[model samples]
Target: MGPGPKVKCPPRLAPCGLRLVQVRFPTGLTSEEYVKQEAWRFARLERCPFHPEGGCGLARHGTYARVSPPGCLIARWWCPTARTSISLLPDFMCSRLTGTLAEVEAVVAAADAAPTREVASEVLRPDVELPGALRWLRRRTRLVHAGLAAAIGLLPGLLARCEPTITSVRSALGAEVALVRLRAELVPHLAALPPPLGFGPRPAQRRSSLTALQQESGTDPPSGTR
Candidate 1:
């Protein structure tokens, strides 16, 4: 069948225009429970976040659903002056990625604990083919490494002394819930970093998978792949 036609991704909703505000949820809060109780209504902005001087006409913009946590609604606010919208995202929900932060952490933790990316893929995602699984795992690992790097730069007093590695981070902070702890610590500065950790915009998508895979392994790209 030669090569299949490329699939088109749906247009992102206001890529640069949307900002995120992290909100904490009570323990054991499920997506279903969140929707049923109309939890989105609870997230409120007293004044215009963009224009705190007073009079920017910030209004409640309704809610948006998340794909991972089915039925969960994120509350939104619109600013007329800035022409941007802010979404109140619950901390449990991963910012840019689909699944929750806990799920993302599990994937990365498993990969880090394993001997190699190849080994980790086989153990953590046996259902997926090796190449596909590596790509999936690589994405999470790269994003997390980026987030950790940002964390270190932002909190130099606490983290600057430590080496820039996940193991070092886990050792410096809590082992099991390092990502969760980092998220809470980065709450004030979330706007500067990108998601799964913060609300900052994601970097541009790479065009070449082979290059990404090569970069992930820190090896020269194999001949004949490109």
Candidate 2:
């Protein structure tokens, strides 16, 4: 499976073989040169997951704005077959969360380590005006737990013994990197799960473990590089 939000690309630039064009910008390309650089960045794509009929259906669909990382613009592509757009996001961003992956990881780690509600509040969001920081914490905590349960068929002993929050999960794992492990273990099917915070419009109507369930059920495909 792909490591990023699902979207496919660039083949039939002809002699380059058959595949979808990558929706990327080469390193160091300034915003000023964005349009000019589009051609080269797309050369590395695999295939359009939506419209693979003739490779002519995928078109530039523009970008989305980001905070934390100032001036960031997420690239997107339009798929006529799917009648919807799919965009690629870096590993540092979660599929539906508003914060960057690092930002989310840092907050989780801090919140997990603090021992009391006061400390947890301070560690997660020093200022109440930051609104949604704590909310994101709650939502992501559940997301991690659900993904873990779906993947391993059980929660760590400590978490099972206490509240099933990231704070508890971290304590159960007794490791500093538990959040990272959770993020890494997370699969795309998260897109379909019930959002602990709330729901937005999306195609994945119900939860299905794209990778973890298959492995747990003994029906997983061969291990290979993502």
Candidate 3:
């Protein structure tokens, strides 16, 4: 069988947007219990007659909750990618700190709401053009060209020896392998060499250290943090 094709990493992050919410539950509850509570709350909301019943309506759904030490439950709700509405629970709770369910319902009724933002077309843009295939072709073409040039430079010797085909093949193969190895070694060494005199931090190392800092902080690291 012929050699399998090589795989390359894609150049961009996936188009999907991830939303994370951090919900704190009372201490001593297990992850399962917190998730159950969230699920129940969501279900209650979904069944409530007050809930809007149409495009982008709210509904309770099961979701994985990350449980941290000392009984912290972070429940995340993902707004649909196309929907951008922010829940007013924060404001509602703050405003109606001491009120009956009916009174709170009045507050919910009184709050004037705004429409959610539309998803940006640019955000869902198509994948980038594939340059990997073109790059590989160029490298191979250069190698072939270099080998041909070297062989032509040696043509006189081969003609003198009356062994044109064999000598040409050997010369080209040797030159190609030598060029490949030289590139393999030289490029990495160049990369490993500290940034040019004034160049800033190495991207990979900087990213790793930043990630370490974020993990230590115990908060969701910045987006694209990883």
- Per-prediction TM-score: 0.72, 0.50, 0.21
> Can you write out model 2's per-residue Cα lDDT over 101-214, one digit (the tens) per residue?
445555655666678545676566666533344444555554554544443433343345645455555566676545444434343333433222112222232344233222
Could you tell me which 10 consecutive residues in candidate 3 have the lowest summed lDDT?
88-97
Clashing pairs in 1: none
Please report the TM-score between candidate 2 and the true structure. 0.50
Task: Report the candidate with higher TM-score, 2 versus 3.
Answer: 2
Instruction: Write the residue-wise lDDT of candidate 3 on 133-155 in tens digits.
Output: 22322222222333334333444
Best candidate according to lDDT: 1
Which model scores highest in TM-score?
Answer: 1
Scanning candidate 1 in windows of ten residues, the lowest lDDT window is 217-226
Model 1: residues with Cα > 4 Å off, grouped in runs: 1-38, 165-167, 203-226
Instruction: Residues 1-226, candidate 1: write the lDDT tens digits.
Output: 1232232222442235533444343333545566677787787767655455546566777776666666667777766555566677776667767667778877887888889999999987899889878887988887887888889998887675766557778778856667667877787788778677877765556778546654543211111110
Those runs of model 3 whose alpha carbons end farther than 4 Å from true positions after fitting are: 1-16, 21-54, 69-76, 81-212, 215-226
Segments in model 2 whose C-alpha atoms lie over 4 Å from true places = 1-45, 129-136, 153-226
Q: For candidate 2, what's the RMSD?
A: 13.2
